[model samples]
Target: MDIYQICPEFKKGQITLRQTETQDAEELLNCYSDEAAVPLFNSDNCHGDDFYYTTLERMKQAIDFWDFSYKNRYFVRWTIIINDTEEIIGTIEMFHRIAEDEFNHFGILRIDLQSRFEKQEIINDILEIVNENLYQAFEVNSILTKAIPLAGERIQSLLNNGYSPMNKRFMGYDDYYRRNRVDN
Candidate 1:
């Protein structure tokens, strides 16, 4: 049930994954509040200051969810870390686990290391997480990602890695969203 402690560190030559503790508040705040994180989480229902507060509130909610049911929400989230310096630069999470719903059996989410490593390594980590974790539990393994416009080559890299745009047309709701995310 303890996803953070359950998995061993992310074994690169020297990098790793360690459990995030309450002491990490300041560091996580700094990372999540960065300019790079804003676009990845599209401003869904607010603007300017409201959206900013909403973002922080959303993070609080996530942390709360993580603590809500340690067992099921074990898939909730984890702070990404580098083993050498013991610095937590970012995070990865399950994002959602629709237990009673049939649609999203095992959802995936991750946000980590804007500058720590090349985007390809992040993609590789994502693949590794999926292959080792989620794929072990679900029949279908998928991700819910936001197509941030300014990701530049990063977006192309994700596509190259077998990730596709889910609602490319965005004309109608397929039981997921309220607004039809038409690329108009």
Candidate 2:
């Protein structure tokens, strides 16, 4: 799929995944500011951004950067919303990695969620949608994400969804996982 031409939306059960918008700044601020959630975010190779936006202005700035990234085809970021509450829970980012390392041409996925919603079930639900769609969206053979040992829920959800811990360091970073697409 040519994600640069059009971003797709995915919906199943109580979860909705759609391209992020400027108006999401206010609701997204809560997830970015959550002290407990900050540590769980995957900020690898982000040039030192920890994804902690404590204020509305900072959140807006981050959202602006996401927009710029999407426009430039640097990556695509989708906001995660819970249908029942209409609350913005987090975001999912995916990009086609271009590198000389073993991960070349792979899809890099980054999922950031509020600590309260970090349960294995909720994460499984979120990953279900992404796992079904992102491989084609990013046109990659496999997808990778980060999950530290401390992130038990995330690790379990990933394992349940066909992901396994990657033994090699990802561009000098550790605690990464990989899941290859199985051809039908």
Candidate 3:
């Protein structure tokens, strides 16, 4: 499916993933400005964006850029919301990589969340929903995400969800884990 043509929304339990909007700036500011969560964000190959916005204006600009990127088919970003509290906790970015290296045609998944929700269970819940859909949505052989050594909970969750450490570096970045669509 062409995700850019029709962005799909996924809902599972209290977690909801939908196309990000400008209205998300206020709540998402809390996630972008979160110092503790910033380090866990995968900003590799993002042209130094770093994903750290300190103000509402900056966050809005970032959202605008995300919209631009989506329009150009560069990537799709979704806001992660809690159904119960209706809080925007974070965002998930996914793109189809077309490179000359080993990652060519692979789906790159990036999950950024508030520091307080960085537990293994939370990560598992989020991944459970994404893993069930992104492979088909992005039409890729595998999906890759970053989980540095410091992100112990994220690493464990990835492992439990059938992901493994990729021995090779991704676009000169490290600490990436991979999950294939078909089991080997």
Candidate 4:
């Protein structure tokens, strides 16, 4: 896969879209070890051997997915690597025909960051990345993103960046997951 050809939009002069996968997962793990990633990815609440195994499992899945190309087709999920470190900071995934057509475009399926780096500048940079990879350099009207109640600030940042929140409700988490799209 020509992963290097995907133009990267920079963040803090380092993170971009062109980084190599060789160092992606390991570096991401260091950042993923932060307090923020606990609730999001550590759903199994792992420790020691369990943590190591789980992390390895995750890395394996990532490599497999990245290497799995369908006849030169670009997969919907794009890994966002940090500038200086070149590790995956987050993922911007796009799923087509989401949940019976509740929304479209890229939905930020997952955003794991070092809780210490939760600043507006970083937030806006991510928005720029989203705009760069999204349809028409802007999030489509039909495309909407949803966050947990606790992610208010992050959601606000997106709105401030011109992403409008649609007034829609869902009945279940699984249903939302089934329909969730990514805004990469």
lDDT of candidates 1 onward, in order: 0.48, 0.91, 0.91, 0.46
lDDT of 1: 0.48
Q: Model 2 over residues 1-184: C-alpha lDDT tens digits?
A: 5988899988877789999999999999989999999899999989999999989999999999999999999999999999899899999899999998778999999999999989887788778887888888788989999999899999999999999999889888899999999765
lDDT of 4 by residue, 142-183 (tens): 333445545555666666666655445432332122222244
Ranking by TM-score: 2, 3, 1, 4
- lDDT-sorted candidate list, best first: 3, 2, 1, 4
lDDT of 3 by residue, 1-184 (tens): 7899999998887689999999999999999999999999999988889999999999999999999999999999999998889899999999999888867999999999999988887678788887888888888989999999999999999999989999788888899999989632
Pairs of residues clashing in candidate 1: 10-17
* Structural similarity to truth (TM-score) of each candidate: 0.61, 0.97, 0.96, 0.60
Worst 10 residues of 3 by lDDT: 175-184
List runs of model 2 lying over 4 Å from the truth.
Answer: none
Better of 2 and 4 by lDDT: 2
Model 4 TM-score is 0.60
| Position 87, candidate 4: lDDT | 51
Pairs of colliding residues, candidate 2 = none
